[model samples]
Structure formats: C-alpha cells, structure tokens
Target: MKKLLLAMGLSTFSMAASAAMVDFNTADADGNGAVTMEEAAAALPEVSPDAVAAADSNGDGVLTVAEYEALASQ
Candidate 1:
C-alpha cells in the first residue's frame, strides 16, 4: 500500500488501513510552516476534507507539522 501510494503520487487513502505515511516537508510543497487545504489536497488529492478538518485539532485552517503528523497517523 505504501508503494502504491507513492507510485500513484498521493491518491485517495483509506486512512484506517493506511500505513503509507505522509512526509510533512514533502507534502508541504511550498516550504510553508503549515499545510493549507490546498497543500493537503495537492499532497493527498482524494483525501476527504472532513478527514483533514478532523486532523486540524487547532482549527487554525492550516496544518502545522504536528497536525500533519497526526493526520498521517490517522
């Protein structure tokens, strides 16, 4: 699954089943301190908005590296 996700370049993920961890810096794409919705979508195109929101514990509208890490763990 990890290889598949890598090969597909951030396709939809089954979070509960996922082990294809997201690399924060790689996903950030712009070197920004946080990952915005656009950045998250760009990194994981088919990932659900609800999922992202769920991961954004702070509700700050952007995912800090820690937030992103939490998202990946989901």
Candidate 2:
C-alpha cells in the first residue's frame, strides 16, 4: 500500500539522518571520552579553538559527544 511504502521511506530517512551524526571516535583521537581543542582541530580544521571553547558547556576545557555534536551542527 502507499501508506506502507511511505512508512518505509520515512524510516529509511530517519536511519540516514542518525547515521549522519558526527563520529565521536574520529574526533577523539586518543580514545578519550572527550575531545580537546587539538583533537577537534585535527578532525575539524575549519573550526576555531575559540568556537570549541565556547561549545564546552561544562567549562571543562574539553568537549563531550553532546558538546561536539552541538558544534558540528552549527
């Protein structure tokens, strides 16, 4: 049915969107749970250190997965 096809299409789209999320491992080169400015720079050269600092929601001088995702989304 058309409805079933639409549901399958929507599910596929959702899966693709989730898959497009940033890969934390790529940014966390040292296998740390968080990313430092140096690691972020390696993965995202277009981003500035100041921007990474601003994205550090916890003021811990590093970025967790959530923080990194927020920066990537921007």
Candidate 3:
C-alpha cells in the first residue's frame, strides 16, 4: 500500500509538472518583461494586497516577471 501511494504521488507530481504555464513575457506589461505593483495587481486582481506585498521580495512595491514566474513555477 505504501509503495502504491508513493507511485500515485509521483504520478500526480509529474502531471502537475507537465501542465501548461502562463508565459511571463505576455503577462508583463509596459514591455519591460517585469510586473510592477499595478501590473501584478492587474494580472491577478483577485489576489489580496497583503499577498502582493508578500511576493515583493525586495519590498520595492512591485513583482518582476521572473519573480512571478518563480512563484507560478512553485
């Protein structure tokens, strides 16, 4: 049973990894390939302000494409 569960978990992980990802190049506005606070908020309007701030690692009040991509990849 343990082995079966492990295999199922691995299969689920593989399926998740193979899923299509939203291209950051297209998501980033202003043609800078980075997501500013306004851009991030625009892209994910449903996200709370606190969540947006949390994603801003540098505390620059913005999230870059790379940063958003990293978050999505996880």
Candidate 4:
C-alpha cells in the first residue's frame, strides 16, 4: 500500500511538472492570446484530436491558457 501511494504521488508530481513547463504563453507559439488546435497539437503530440476538441470547451477552435493547462495536467 505504501509503495502504491508513493508511486501515485510521483505520478501526480510528474504531471504537474510537465504542465508547468509548458505554459500557455510558451505554447501559444504565434503570440496570440489563445492557443490554436495546431499549437496545442504541436505542444502535446500524445493528445488526440478528440482530446483537443474536448479541451476547447468554448468551441472557439482554440484553447485558452486555462484550458491548455487543464489538458496538460491530465
């Protein structure tokens, strides 16, 4: 149980670190206020098209920093 807890904690920490490393400003690429699908895709290759679509909750075809951060955290 202790080992499992430790592993989980480590996983959470790593996810947080990765999310922090890629802030919205840096990922925006074009210096726009929002991150486009292309920018999000480029920043997170592991994320699927569906995931990107889901992250864009506003349906504006772009991810705000908060949205991108949330997606990265996942």
Each candidate: what lDDT? 0.73, 0.73, 0.59, 0.75
Per-residue CA lDDT of model 4 for 1-74, tens digit only, reads: 85465446545655766533555765676787999999777666667989989999889899998888888788
TM-score of each: 0.68, 0.67, 0.55, 0.69
lDDT, candidate 3, residue 64? 77
Candidate 4 TM-score, true structure as reference: 0.69
User: Which sequence of candidate numbers ranks them by TM-score, best first?
Assistant: 4, 1, 2, 3
Candidate 2 residue spans exceeding 4 A from truth: 1-22
Can you give the lDDT of residue 34 in candidate 2? 91
- Candidate 3 lDDT by residue in tens digits, 23-63: 46534655686777676555454556577678778877667
Question: 47 in model 1: Cα distance from truth in Å?
Answer: 2.0
- In terms of lDDT, model 3 sits at 0.59
Query: Where is model 1 more than 4 Å wrong at Cα?
Result: 1-20
User: What clash pairs does model 4 have?
Assistant: none
Q: Give the worst 10-residue stretch by lDDT in candidate 1.
A: 11-20
Identify the leading candidate in terms of TM-score. Answer: 4
Candidate 3 off by > 4 Å: 1-22
